[model samples]
Target: MKKLTIAFLIITLFMPKQSNAQSNGAAGAIAVGAGLLAIGAGIAAMEDMKERAELTATQWVLANHPELNSFSLKTLDFNGKKTKDMSSTSVISFKIQEFSPTDNPTLDGKKQILLAFTSYGWISDQGIDFNKVNWYLIDSTEWLNMMVAYAKVASKEKNETVLKDVLNNGLVVNKGIKAKGKTEIPFFKLEGDMYLVTDYSSEMKLVYNEKTLGIFLKDTGNLVQMARAAVIDTHEFFFLTK
Candidate 1:
């Protein structure tokens, strides 16, 4: 993660020293440096939030499903994703499930199963962005950037229609919609005055026949104990870090 961050800093350093918007070299440097500084600071803050969210997720796993102490985990970066992308999730599966649960319906009706999790945030004319797509594939990042672009147009030209257009765009983009046959998933909401501003973390569960699989322990005795007892003893599941 730090390596990727270093590359961002390097990009800022290599930006052109002169810009037509600046009257002189000193002015240009000052303006550019200030923007870069804000971006870098915001990135650092958001990174910290992401780490905190990950730790909270780990705790949830331990408390609710201790067997998953060995569950494979992965933290992925989704900041650069565009609205057209289809990768809404990442999954982790095991090689075997010899300790299948009775009445389990996965892996030949055995308890062997697959698991997945998700987290997302967005860029608000700043450096940090989180990505998730579940609708017509629009994401917070794309919508925010579009609003800013339209705002710039209205600001520069002072057109009432431009402002109205931007407002309409926001309405269409963010207005909530419902999907059929969707089951409620468990999630953690991370929102505050600091880095995460807006985001959520979740582990996807599969529901069918009044039971959920894929890492969901539906109030059956001590969940952590059940997890610990049935989980795979291999490298396929682990707590991965940046």
Candidate 2:
């Protein structure tokens, strides 16, 4: 785990910077325009209904789960879309860290989970609302455990279907729906039991309801990769389950 963390940090440290330079040397102008455009677009596309719902959810999580108060919120653009055209779609991420009771004596009395929250959304064409597509909450310890469990299960069973089944059915829990606008938002709950057998320093899991939409691993991988690419030596990586 330490090696993986170090490797990720090293790669991030040397990653290319996001340049806005253009061929005509109007880079600064273009950048300023783009920034203003994004801000304007965001404001113009703002949907009070969605914002209220998101705020409600965020407030509920913060008030109910005080342990997650330290987590940060962030916004990002989607890079995997085929069209290079700019859109109102954006991603929001939250991250936190969890340590074992024995490892951190100070926090031993507190909850055992270090939770992170991240999500993705798009601004409507009308630019009056945001359409959220994906969201995730994870415990670092649980994530480490799950990875180890996956490796072990894969080595033993070598069956992708079975492995997927174990991950989707046995390890993950379907939370209820979150009403946002006209859409019924699906959510999930996860536990540490799924990854306890793995030799990981911690355990973590993310959940989403399949009745509304299927969560894809590839999307999760992309989010992780993007977060890793942006920050070096920082355990706070952004991600979403679907």
Best by lDDT: 2
Q: In angstroms, how far off is 178's CA in candidate 2?
A: 38
- TM-score for all models, in order of appearance: 0.30, 0.30
Instruction: lDDT for model 1, please.
Output: 0.32
- Candidate 2: misplaced stretches above 4 Å? 1-57, 63-91, 97-122, 127-134, 149-242
Kindly give the number of clashing pairs for every candidate.
Answer: 7, 11
For 193-222, candidate 1 gives per-residue lDDT tens digits of 211111111321221111111222222211
lDDT, candidates in the order shown? 0.32, 0.34
Model 2 residue 134 lDDT?
A: 45
Q: TM-score: which candidate is best? A: 1
lDDT at position 224, candidate 1: 12
lDDT (C-alpha) at residue 7 in model 2: 45
